[model samples]
Target: MNEEELGTDLKKRIKEVLSGSLHIRHVDTGSCNGCDFEMSTLSNPIYDISRFGVSFVPSPRQADMLMVTGGVTSNLEKALRITYEATPKPKMVLAIGACACGGGVFGETYANAGGIDPFVPVYVYVPGCPPRPQALIQGILLALDQYEEVLKRGE
Candidate 1:
């Protein structure tokens, strides 16, 4: 095979590595805990996120994806940045609510850093004061699609 063909084959392999499942690491910057509650329900028997190959891990190092909620408050900025850094490469960050996506009601206040995107790259932005569990699931799946595309590009 030619070099060009080999490059295409390599990209295909990278994408295939991400097609299976995503284990998440959830972070709450400075929201009202509304989105956190919704995330907790995802693991319950009703939502059963595990069945979908989505589960929350305790440490960022062990997580496959990062799910962040609430605006990036100044106090939590370092922690958020560090957590994102610790998560492995090719990891996707999902902004779980309006605050995390674009600061919501807080909106770049003295204490808020606007959105998580400013601190770390965000792949999917799930909008809502506190989005429904279903929305979060959809956001994860959507990010998964983008995630594969990103890997294909060798980025």
Candidate 2:
């Protein structure tokens, strides 16, 4: 499919996964805050993701999706696990940025504990040192595709 078609398909899948409920909780393990900055901008006037029926939640327990950024750090492992554990069933994790997906610049650093996938299964990975907001959105939409099928099977 063409890029536009693919994007449209992704959006459709996202809508299906959401099914009128798409609350996300963001976690920062040890990011440089660049990803966080773009994520925050997603809610602003320019590209309000709320228009697509998505919202950012403060508590993990109340979220249907976990949007994690940054490389997994030794100090934040416990917190990350707790956050994931707190999230209710049928939740998907989206690792945004190269750091979160592959440890990026900190891959072999003393403080690095690897990527998010090692600790918790990542449904999607947006690969960029600091992924653009559009890239993050696309990753979320891709995860939604698999998430919808999983939910349908009641897994």
Candidate 3:
């Protein structure tokens, strides 16, 4: 299916799976802002993920998913943990960008914690120096699929 078809299908799936909406909280650990910018693009008219019942929320307490970007920095490790704990149960965590997946070029530095996996359970990983908006959407869809499975297992 083309992107339009996919968007329509994704909208339906999100509604059925997430009880109408999926609110995301974005966390930036320590990379450049490229991935963050790409994620923000989903709210633009062209992508308009809001129509799919997907929105970026300001607080983890209000989020259904955590779209984490950048490598885990020492300064942000505690914050990440707190954010994860603050989110309600059955939440999905998506590690976006290469930096979040494996720390990118700044891998395991004195100030960087390598990847988010060491800190929290990641449900999806979208790898790239900075993945495009399309990839980010794909990652979200993947996370939704996993969420569906988790629900089915009553987890």
Candidate 4:
């Protein structure tokens, strides 16, 4: 599909995913807070992801999607896994930023082991060293597509 059509399709799928009960929990593995900053903008009046039927939760256990950012640090691996496990079935993971996707500039460093995919099954990858808010929103919409697929397969 063309870009516009694809975006429309994604928005439809996101609506479907939100038709059911779903909430997102954000995790900052070891980012420089740039990704976090962009994510925070999603809640601002302009973007207002809530109007799109998405909301961020505080606890992982209460979340249906895990929005993770930053390179995965060895110390945070266990916590990340625990958080993923805490999320119930039919969960989705969104790896935002170059750091979360492939460790960005921190890859192979002693501090960071790798990206978030190794720690959890990432459903969507938003690649940017520090992604813009619009890009992050697109990633979120893509994740809702995955979420809809899972629901379709009756998983």
Candidate 5:
């Protein structure tokens, strides 16, 4: 779907699954910031994800979803785990970009731990060197579907 359609769908999904708001905590494990930059665009006028009831929170404790970018670096592994633990239950974790999805060019190294699956349960993976804002919205929509299913199962 187009970005506009995706945004409309995302708004509906957030209203249904999250009481009309979806607070996200964005974490940058150890990326070069490419993915993070793309994610930031969602807040700009062109994308304006906030208009769809999505907003980025400063703390995981206040977030309904975690939008993680970059490879799981050794230095940030503990921090990532802590953030995931801090987020309330029924939370959705989205792995953004190729690095967070896998290892990207950085790969598994002595300082990087590859993908984040080993640290936290990821509900969606938006793969790209730096996925566009449209892809991020789509990922959130996909996560909302899974989150709704989990809620129905009472998990």
Candidate 6:
């Protein structure tokens, strides 16, 4: 299906399967910090993502989703694995921007590990040098939708 259709379906499924709020833990593996700015915009006056029941938390243990930015770097690979393990099961991993999705221009460098998928499963990928806030929101919703599907399928 098209992105538009997928987005609508995600919204519907999220509402159907989830109730109340969800806490997200933001992880910055390695990047130019461009994606971080777009993420901050999500909570700003214009978008105000908190109204949608998503809040950012500091710890992975307290989070339902892992909002990952940047490509994984060699130094942080172990930390990333530990964080993923800390996150409770039935979790969703949201890979934001080109860097996190596939390492962007820094692909497979000596210091860059490319993507988070090899270390942790990525449920939704938002592709852009810095994806717009709308895209970020869509990615979050998509993650929720996928999480709901996983729960329903008992997997």
Score candidate 3 by TM-score against the native: 0.94
TM-score, one value per model: 0.85, 0.90, 0.94, 0.87, 0.96, 0.89
Instruction: Report the lDDT of model 4 for residue 41.
Output: 88
The TM-score measured for candidate 2 stands at 0.90
- Clashing pairs for model 4 are none
lDDT of 4 by residue, 1-155 (tens): 23554435445666566664448899888889988988898888977767656689999888888989889888888889999999989898999899988878888687897688766888988998788877776776777777777888998
**Worst ten-residue run, lDDT, model 5?**
1-10
Residue-wise C-alpha lDDT for candidate 1, range 47-129, written one tens digit per residue: 77666556688999988789998898889999998998898888889999889888888888899988888788789899987
Candidate 2 local lDDT, 1-155, one digit each (tens) = 23555445545666666656589999999899989999998889987777777789989999999999998888998999999999999989999888998888888577897688879998988888677777877787778778878878988
What tens-digit string does per-residue lDDT give for candidate 5 at 8-101? 8888878888888999999999999999889899998988888999899999999999999989989999999999999999899999999998
Which parts of model 5 have CA positions greater than 4 angstroms off?
1-4
lDDT for each candidate structure: 0.80, 0.83, 0.89, 0.80, 0.90, 0.82
User: Can you write out model 3's per-residue Cα lDDT over 103-128, one digit (the tens) per residue?
Assistant: 89888889998899999999999998
Q: Indicate the worst ten consecutive residues by lDDT in candidate 2.
A: 1-10
After TM-score superposition, the amount by which residue 38's alpha carbon in candidate 3 deviates from its true location, in angstroms, is: 0.4
Candidate 1 regions off by >4 Å?
1-19
The C-alpha local distance difference test score for the whole of candidate 1 amounts to 0.80
Off by over 4 Å in 2: 1-14
In candidate 6, what residue range of length 10 has the lowest lDDT sum?
1-10
* Top model number, TM-score: 5
Give the Å shift of residue 102 in candidate 1.
1.3
lDDT score of model 3? 0.89
Best by lDDT: 5
TM-score, candidate 5, is: 0.96
Q: Model 1: which residue pairs collide?
A: none
